[model samples]
Target: MKKINLENKTILVTGAAGFIGANLVLKLLHEVSRINIVGIDNMNDYYDVGIKEWRLEEIKTKADDNSTDSSWTFIKGDIADKEMVDKIFSQYHPDIVVNLAAQAGVRYSITNPDAYIHSNLIGFYNILEACRHSGDDSGKKVEHLVYASSSSVYGGNKKVPFSTDDKVDNPVSLYAATKKSNELMAHAYSKLYNIPSTGLRFFTVYGPAGRPDMAYFGFTNKLLKGETIKIFNYGNCRRDFTYIDDIVEGIYRVMQGAPDQKNGEDGLPIPPYAVYNIGGGRPENLLDFVDILQQELLNAGVLPKDYNFEAHKELVPMQSGDVPVTYADTTALERDYGYRPSVDLRTGLRNFAEWYKKFYID
Candidate 1:
């Protein structure tokens, strides 16, 4: 393994206004000094653009509050635009690149396959191509390329905890298929260009200022509107609900410890590439998770104390692109990075609920 010193390094983070990306920028600003950080985001209206803007504001506030020798630059642009991607690479010449700008949400992929292909596939290709040529002329190469994968790649496998070694050719949704493709593309790029790369298969990540498309956030919205919230698989789902903070911490740790390039017996360069599952090892039942979420809503004053939760929920059969369970085997992450998600569902939901009250209700 190779240890990367983040201090004085130039890092480019795509999807800078996103939930994970914003938090990661904040973390970098707080933890690493004398760093030059560049961020880019399309700021699509897939969810509320307000949320993305708000996250950017938070990052800006943090950058201002920190009196250290760190800097942040944000560009509103799309990675799918090869010209724009190439411009950023040529101008910044970042040492580390984190690609998190892909179109998210499995169900959304079913209705809008074009978005997935455009961003997930083509955008990723552009990033890889740019990384491949970053060293040309500039003589400065990207040290590590980290990108996001999804647990949905596990598909309908009956595995308890999905491992990195697990077969993921069978993706249930276009989103999953695209994420799987990302891992494959990264592997090929690593082999061809000897670029150090890592892919994280994130489980159901949740927390404050999270994506509103996620279940907990959407459920809060529905409950607040006195509408029914559908529980998929007739309340038989189990999910590894990893918190945003934990996910950010995992990414931070993984960024500094890139896989080392090696030479094989055939006198060929082996790819310095790896993939790991970043998740809370424990899986929580969907029904129990909802129960805790409601309790937290009440505790946070987002929901009335006497609200009738039982009347606002309905059990429904699984959707077309939905799976019954998503459990991640994070043993490899812990083994390699010495870290695993530790936040529990209740605490995570509580934080989200409190944030909801502050953001909307209050």
Candidate 2:
């Protein structure tokens, strides 16, 4: 992998404590020289604050290594707070801004829709405003703004291998709706301010120290406790399960290679913005995924060999905001960046099992 030069560049990564944010920050710090990173996360107990703190601890340990003079600064703040966001932008004047903070979870949005509005809507607005105004004082505008979108925006479309050109106006859930809205808002901002914004519609990202609310992590816990794991939609679903490392790698590549103006029919730069699907591109069956996960847990010593795994799985009706299948079309990403996620599901599951054993079982 050819590493890009990011020396002397200050970058701001929101949702630093989240799974993807932490991974991206660690990768950037180790790869870039003389780089300064400012990470902000409210550290809400949406899952476990301890896990978030542990991720920060790992980042701090790497940053303190004397071999690299690169700096990592963390701030406990919310993106919705305009005053605090403005202050950080003014102080750091980051060359690149990556916004990964948002109210996640699809089903949760059904009951708690307001959270999505506050974070995804108001919070993202605050980030855009800060990025736009950051250069006013120092005349150093943010070169690129990369934000997280989701594959859920595809909704109930019957299309295989969802592409950026596909119409995503029909969002099934509030979470998907907000994500789609983010893309639209980013397009407008990119056209108006030339922010060179890139929105990544990530598929099902899972790996070590992932969110507990996710099916893989939650099912692991249920299996360990000898409890029945609810297999929603009768385990007839398919997901493009992207590994965390793959996602981090994709983000790093897209960050370095910002979107450029493509000539439109009028022979002028079109939108100066782009959206790409960062996913495994290979969808795995839900039941097959669970079977591999069970074997991995046993291999990691988190599950007994004779455990009643079959009896533990309870088939249930489809849950709201849950899609039957999701597949990604990575042609755009491959053509532009020569990058494609190569992590297989079994390998990724094994890595997660190892981490789960060490973190919870040990």
Candidate 3:
């Protein structure tokens, strides 16, 4: 592995207003000094634009409060725009680039396939192109390019813990397909350009200020409105729920080390590329997860103690483009980075519930 110093480096983070992106920017500002951070996001309304704005606001507040000599510049644009991407590359000349700007959610991809293609496919291609050209004219090359890939790429695999070595050609949804394509595309670029890239296959990520479309957050919103929350696959699904902080920490560690650039026997680049799964190895049952979430909500004052939780839930068949379980085998991540997700489900949900009370109810 090639270690890249983040201090005094220019970093570009796409999806700066996103759940993970904003939090990551905050982490960097707090930890690294004299750094230049550039962010770009289209600010789409996939869930709630207000939440996205709120996350950006948090980043701004953190930047102001941070005593470190770090600077942040945000650009409102889509990565799919080749001109904008090129301009950013030329202007910022970032040493590290984190691509997290993509249309998320499986069911939404089923209905809105165009959004997936536009963002996941074309946007990723644009980023790759920019990375490819970053070394032109003796300019500083991008030391590392880290992008987000989803565990959905596992797609109905019967394995208990999905490994990076597992075949992921059978994507059940367009979103998964796009994420898989990203890995392939990054590998090709790394081989051709020696860009030193890494892809992280994130498991079910959740926590305070998370996406509302996720099951835990959505259930809370529905229960608050006295609406029935559907438990998919008759409540038999299992998920390796990873907390947002864990995810960000994984990204931060992975960013500092890029795959080693080497030469093959044939005198060609060996493609400094790798992929790892960032997840809590433990998979929790959906029913049990909901029960814990309910208790947390009550503890956080988002729900009354005497609320009839049983009446508010309905078990149903699994929806299309949905998997019965997502269990990540993070042995590679742990072995490589010496880090694993340590946040428990109950604790993560409690944090979310408290944030919900403060943001929505308070």
Candidate 4:
């Protein structure tokens, strides 16, 4: 593994306007004085495009205030388009590529499976192709390729803390299958093209300005509308809800340390590839999570102190593709990168409560 200096490097972050992508891009733009960041996103209305636009606006402001105007560039394009992806790769010649763009959500994949095939499979293949050809006829080469996977790949594993070493062959949801496929595809590309790649299996990530489709965001919206909020699996599920900032930090460190290069006895470059889970490690029950969320909302004035929380709660059966628990074994992440996502639920939920008030209520 090589330690990289962010200064004077050009990085390509797909889905730059999306939740995690936007946050990662912001950090790079403001923190690294001399780095060039090229972010590409289709800005699809998978959720509200308003939030995406808001993140982009914040990035622009950060660039302006930091006087790093030349360091940030955003392209409104879809990764599924082969020509568009090829064009961006050829034009930017980015030194590092972080692929975060994908059709996210498990339940959404039940009826809308085609979206997953287009974005997750083909889109990812296009990236692999671009990275494979990035060094062709050019002096510049992509130093690393870091892509997002999901803990959902664990599927119905009867394990406590899911480890990357565990077999993820049985994916219950289309979303999980696609994510697992991504890891396999990346491995093949890395081995054949000698591209250094790392795949991140993210847990239930939640935070301010997150995807509205997620349970946390959906629950808040429903409660605000005075509607019943469904508690899936009869409130028996537990999740390792990781915060966005901690996820970004984990990604930043992983980017700097690509898997060590290896060669076979025949001297052919063997792909240096690795995978790890990024999560809080502490699994919080859904009911307890909601309790904290309610308190935080009250504390932040997003909800009235006298709001009838019990009236809005509705326990329901587990939907298809749902699991009982998702606990991450983050030992590898901590051992390799010296970082672990340990943000307490209360602190994280409080931050979301405050942000929710400012964004929607205020």
Candidate 5:
């Protein structure tokens, strides 16, 4: 693999305390020298703040390595705050901006729609504006803007393997709607302002220090506490679970391969924007996934062999904003970047189980 140079480049990563954001930040610091990273997160009580703090501690430990003066700065602020965003942009003048901050969770969006509007809508708008105008006086333009989209954008489509060309106008939940809106907004900005942007439709991302609200993490917790775990959709659903390391690698490749406008029927460059589905192409059955997870937990000493795992399993109807199955068509990603997520489900689950045992159980 050829190394892409990020030396002396200042990068801004929003939602830096989140699962994916923290992992990406650590990878960048490890790969680049003379790099300065500015991470912004509100530290909301969405999940455990302890996980966020632990992620920050990991970054700090890496930053302290004296071999490279790569500095990591954390800002406790909301991205929706225009003043704070503008101030940070002015201060850092980042060469690249990765926006991962958003109101996540499908069920949560059903009850609290306002939170999605505030963070996903308003916060994203503020970031785009800042990126557009940040270089006016400083003469340091944002080279690329990469943002997170979700597989939920596929909604209740009948398609098996979702593609970027598929119509995503029919979002099932407010969370999905906001993510689709982000892609549209990014396209418009890319067209009007000539800003290069790429939106990544991430599949079910699960790994160490994962989000507790996700089914896998939540199920683990419920099983540990001797509570019934809700197996929605009668444990018949399938998910394209992509590990965190693969996701970070995909993002790093896409960051370097920023889209460019091309001549269209109008004889002008089409918008300098693109979208890709980042997922493990393979889909695993829900029941099989749980079985593997249970075995892994027992092996890690987090669960007892005599534990009544079957008694704790409850098959329930599918909830709103949930899809039966999600698979990704990684043809474009592999063709363009020569990368594909190859982490097997069992391997990924084992890693997550080990992390959970060490972090929460021990």
Candidate 6:
């Protein structure tokens, strides 16, 4: 794998105002010096645009407070627009591109499959195409293209620990199918264009200031409103609930290490591509996870200790496109990067609870 030098490099992060994207940009700006980051997002109202705007503000605050050596530039545009994407690539000529903008929600995909096709497929294709031509007219080349994939791609796998090597052919939801297609598309692009790419299959990512669409954040919102929180699959399911900080850490490490560019004896580009599961290795049961969340909420004063937890929780059958379990085999991530997501549910929930209290309640 080719190791990249972070100094004086321009990194382009799509979905920069989004949850993970904003957090990733904040981390990069704080930690790395002498680097410029260009962020692109259509800033569509998939959820609360207010939160997205707030995150962008937070990034600005963090950037201002942190190292003076780093800088950030945000462009309000969609990657699916070929002209917009081409313009950004032409303007910045980013040495690295992290594609995170996508129509994210599995349930949302049922009602709107076109969003998935437009963003995940076409948007990603434009990114690959941009990277393919990035080196043109300029000596600067995109050394790495790290993109987001979802554990939903594992889709009904009977396996306990979902390995990257697992066959993800049977995607139950349009979201999963799109994510799986990204991996396949990345592979083809890597082989054809030799664009070193790494796809991260993220498991249930939860943290403070997170997506309102996600279960944890949504549950908090409902509980605060004295509404019933639906526990799908009768709370029998399990998930590798990775925290936002851990996910960003994994991404930062992967950004520096691109899959080794090697050629076959046949003298063709050997597809410098890799996939890793960035997840909590320990899969916590849904009920247990909820319990931890409740405790943390109470601890953070987001919920009273005497709050009627049972009254707010509604255990229901699993929704279509939802899985019974998602367990990640982080052997490859650990072996290669010497790091795997280790944040426990309680600890992670505590952080979220604190953030929720500060951001929403307090």
Off by over 4 Å in 2: 1-4, 261-270
lDDT of 6 by residue, 1-362 (tens): 78898879999999999999999999998789888999989999889998899999999898778765888898999899999998889889999999999999999999999999999999999999999999896867799999999999999999879998888899999999999999999999999989999999999899878999999999889999999999999999998889999999999999999999988999988999999999988888989989888989899999888999998888899999999999989889988887767677888889989988988877
Off by over 4 Å in 1: none
Instruction: Indicate the worst ten consecutive residues by lDDT in candidate 3.
Output: 134-143
The model with the greater lDDT, 1 or 4, is: 1
Give the top-scoring candidate (lDDT).
3
- Model 5 — which ten-residue stretch has the worst lDDT? 1-10
Best of the two (1, 3) by lDDT: 3
**lDDT of each residue in 1-362, candidate 5, tens digit only:** 12335788888999999999999999898887788899999999989999999998988888887367788999999999999999999999998899999999999999999999999999999999998897898988888899999999999888889888888889999999999999989988888777888899999999999899998899999999999999999998999999999999999888777776456797765777888899999989999999999999999888998988989999999998898999998899899888789789899989999999999878
List candidate 6 segments past 4 Å from native: none
- Tens digits of per-residue lDDT for model 2, 1-362: 12235788899999999999999999988888888999999999889998999999999989988355799999999998999999999989998899999999999999999999999999999999987787899999888889999999999878898988999888999999999999989988877666778899999999999999999999998888889999989988999999999999999998887777455687655666879999999999999999999999999989988888978989998898899999999998898888799899999999999999899879
- Give model 6's TM-score versus the native structure: 0.98
Better of 1 and 6 by TM-score: 1
| Candidate 3, 244-326: lDDT as tens digits | 99999999999999999999999999999999999989999999999999999999999988999989999999999999999
Error of 1 at 82 (Å): 0.6
lDDT of 1 by residue, 1-362 (tens): 99999999999999999999999999999999899999999999999999999999999999988877899999999999999999999999999999999999999999999999999999999999999999997999999999999999999989788888888888999999999999999999999999999999999999999999999999999999999999999999999999999999999999999889888998777999999999998999999999999999999999899999989999999998889998888888888899867888888999999999999987
TM-score of each: 0.99, 0.96, 0.99, 0.98, 0.96, 0.98
The CA lDDT of each predicted structure is 0.94, 0.91, 0.95, 0.92, 0.90, 0.92
Instruction: Please give the lDDT score for candidate 5.
Output: 0.90
4 or 5, greater by lDDT: 4
